[model samples]
Target chain A: MTGTGGRARYLWLGGLVAICLGLLALAAWQLVVLERQMRIAATENMIWVFGQTQIEALNLALALSDEAALQQIQTRFDILVSRLTLLEDGPQRRFLENAGVSETLARWRSGLLALDPAQGADPAALRAHVTALVAALRTKASLVMSHEWQSQATRLDSLRHLHLLALMSVLGAAVAGLGLVAILIDRERRLMSGQLDHLRAEKLASDLERERETSENHRRFADLIAHQFRTPLAVIDSAMHRLTRRSGGPVPPELISEKAAVSREAVARLVKLTDTALMMSRLERDAVLPSLRAHDLNDLVSSVIDDLMATAWDRDPARIRQSVQTEPTVALCDPMLTAEILSNLLRNALLYSPPDCRVDVSVFQSRDCIVCRIEDRGRGMSPEEIECAFDRFYRGSGHETLPGSGLGLTLARDLARIQGGDVTLSQRDGGGLTAALYLPKDDVA
Target chain B: MSLRYHIVQTALMTALVFMAVPAAAEDVLLTLTGAVTDGRVEMTRADFDTMDWHEFSTSTSVTDGRPEFRGVLMRDALAHAGAEGSSVRATALNDYVVDIPVEDFHRFDVLAALYMDDVPLTPRDKGPVWIVYPRDNHGVLADIRYDMRWVWQLVALHVQ
Candidate 1:
């Protein structure tokens, strides 16, 4: 995979880790809150139970006659005893037993039983017994209430302690999570720095290698041109010298015309070779960075079409037709680079078109980008040709009849990439070729 | 074992009879007696103003109708009487009595209401006085500790 793609993958992984940690923190906080609420609910329930028990005991004591009151008190006492057992092992349970309030109640119950109404009871003795019973019931109720209060206090204290501990733990975990995030970010930064350094080193080495290769190719081309020129030049000069040395025979017009034509062809070949070498060198070097500015893509296409007008005029009138589908297609880009790409595509379309065919140039805005297409109605290229169409010095099979260096598309593609765009070639719908330039709109400075 | 011994026994018997005559008369005339010693009592204007004894009222029910007597609370009267006792025995004119512990009185507001509404009471109205509480103030008091603050022909507070 490419370096940028790998970096994006790493960033995605980091994002997932951050999301997971966030969810974990949220879950922990929820649990802590739930536990706190549960503790509060338990304390409130205990308070309610204490209040209910006291009220019930008071009501039972008041409703019955002395004989009956004792039995009711006994029954209530039994219920309270059972409830006390349910209080879990705590200070509340201990308080109930230690108060001896329940024993006092039992004694009062027996005292009430002894004072039978059938016997002429002495008022003093009866009053004393009732008073003792009331006192015993009040003491018992107070003991139960106090025990509940103490239990609630203890539970609240423990809950507060637990809350504090949980809060501290959450804070600690959050801090650790933050620390982990920072470390991960730092590691990622270091990795990116290392990768950048490696890329820079590799690029520098490749640049040096490319420079050496270009120099060698230039030298070899110059030598090949010189060697190609030498044979024709030698023939022309030797023939002229021979003719001059003889000084007796008149030179034949046909023979002189043939020699002149041969020399002309050799010079032309030399010029073509030089121009091809220059184009190759231009394509191999990186294009200059574009000074991006907003410009009308439609106007740029129109201007390129104007430049190609003279060349199109040389072809059959019907074949040289051009059309523009959109106007005022505004975009943010380097106008010069956009013009260059459009000019190259238009040139290719016009060059490869058959006689009496049409070349269409269009500029339009697409979603978040601008598209410029140049279509030609001509014999289309094969898939292989389209694939290699943007490569340096590549010429299609059908382009043998065309007199051109094959570096235009390569140069255009390089310029497009520098401007954050690309060039693509495809077969046209009918029977021709179409070239498209996709330029990204500059939304970020 | 002669005439002087008979005379001493007869004189002791007469002295006992004389002491018993006043006790019987007090029971028949007063209808209620004794102080509510120990603990406290609370009264509100809705019942009777025990603080002012002159104005009293009574509520009539079929089971208990008597004159209502306006007076200070039994506990307060006992306090005023400077009585010292561990309990208060509240008795109706019919001789029905309930012993209220001093501690219970301390913990609860046991009131001796002298009025029902804003009118004077008679015996047929079931009161010369009664004991009452503001039971409607809380749900926990909606039952019998409140009901024990009985109305009608209320009579005596005996300190024990």
Candidate 2:
């Protein structure tokens, strides 16, 4: 298509241009012809000139018969010479020469000029000489008139043929130009359609890639759910079974209380896992509607930190450090969603780093938003891991022993978005991951 | 055949020369008859010379070179006879004839040229009175339609 289609277009364009040039040349030629016709540059009516010469010769003969005045006779003779002069020069000379009458016309001119008034000839001899010239003049005039007539007819015929040729060329140029325009328009339409098809193909390819990635994520999520929930559920089942059995007779009061405590602890773990799953499902179905308002971001962060310390036996308050860019760090967001987002980051920081290392939590006010950054002194993940940190069921590779449902970061991001905010994680400068929570700036505050 | 016909035609025309002898007699080179209130008006070289003369230079179809011409306008010439009509029939010494619209007389100062380069016109050199148009001034005059109107060796004007 490239070779043949491109060549054909060039050929069509070249041919049209050539035809237009030819038409222009023809038009210029026609203008020249019309100019020649308009100028009246060639007005020698040869037939009339020839007939006048013979007529004037005879006019002298008539004057001679009337015994007219000498001056009148001389004038008539002079007039005859003037008429013959027409046959002797210019365009008329060329015509008579073509007729092989130049010699005869020259001879007549000499003979007539010889009879000039300066010679003072008598009337009789003058009459005889004019009578002689008239006889020969009569013979040549008919021949010349016929020659002029035939040439005029041929000229007219050829002029008609020229006009026909010019008309056909004009029509040819018009058709060629129109054909060129049609081809260009059609080519433009085809090129646009081809571009649209290419764009559609690209979109389809990207859509297939995204679908495969999502299916892979679902397969990993299935395995994670089985491994994470099976342990807690199995512990609760065994403890309940031991307490309800009658084959061991009445169990000791101490053993019964201890077994009951173990069962209750496992039940709490199961409840936490169930709560995380329920919250994720609610976010996925777009069921959670956040109530937006201006709240102090620092208040939410410090409250989340307090709750984490109270819940875990090993999480020490002295191991955490807090900083604030402004007095309150105010931002526009739902208070509940902001607290949930902050708690997830604080808990992850406490769980991953060594128990003795201090965790840093900072709240700052940027130009358009309030940002809370929680930095931990744990081994930081790679760029690739950080990028996928917000995916459902995602966990750091080496932190499998850490207590987490793996839905923390994903839930945090979803809840923040519902409140018109977002969360991002990055590798800290020294040796840990930094999680940043952003909320819209509180203009009223 | 054309020669014999021309001879008889010339004899008849000479016999019918309009019998216009007047005070100028042999000097009378042109005549006006028919539709002239004076019945017949003969114009000699002297008669033309006495009229108000105008000069215009132009090249003619029958000749080679540009020549200056002096003449009285046809309207002025016809006024001598008090001639009136829509057009006039012009005849040459060779019996060449063409109709000139009366509008031509007033429209373009159509001249009955009596002199070439200040020389009195004799009958031999497109003279006595040749009908000259101001060809150089008007592009319309440089065409065959006007070419035929430039009658030479002119003899009579029958106003009608």
Q: Write down the DockQ of candidate 2.
A: 0.18
Question: Any residue pairs clashing in model 2, and if so which?
Answer: A79-B124
Encode model 2's per-residue lDDT on B1-160: one tens digit a residue: 5366346434432322222122243577788988897778988877777889998999777555777898899899998878978888999876779998889878897889877777555554466688999988887788888888888778999998
- Candidate 1 segments whose C-alpha is farther than 4 A from its true place: A1-95, A98-100, A113-126, A136-145, A247-445, B1-160
Provide the TM-score, chain A, model 2. Answer: 0.71
What's the DockQ for every one of the candidates? 0.02, 0.18
List model 2 lDDT by residue over A309-425, tens digit each.
765544579988997555658888888778878887887887788888889999988888899999999887899999888877778898775567788899999998887789998
**Whole-model lDDT values for every prediction:** 0.56, 0.77
Worst 10 residues of 2 chain A by lDDT: A35-44
Name the docking class for model 2.
incorrect
What DockQ would candidate 1 receive versus the native complex? Answer: 0.02
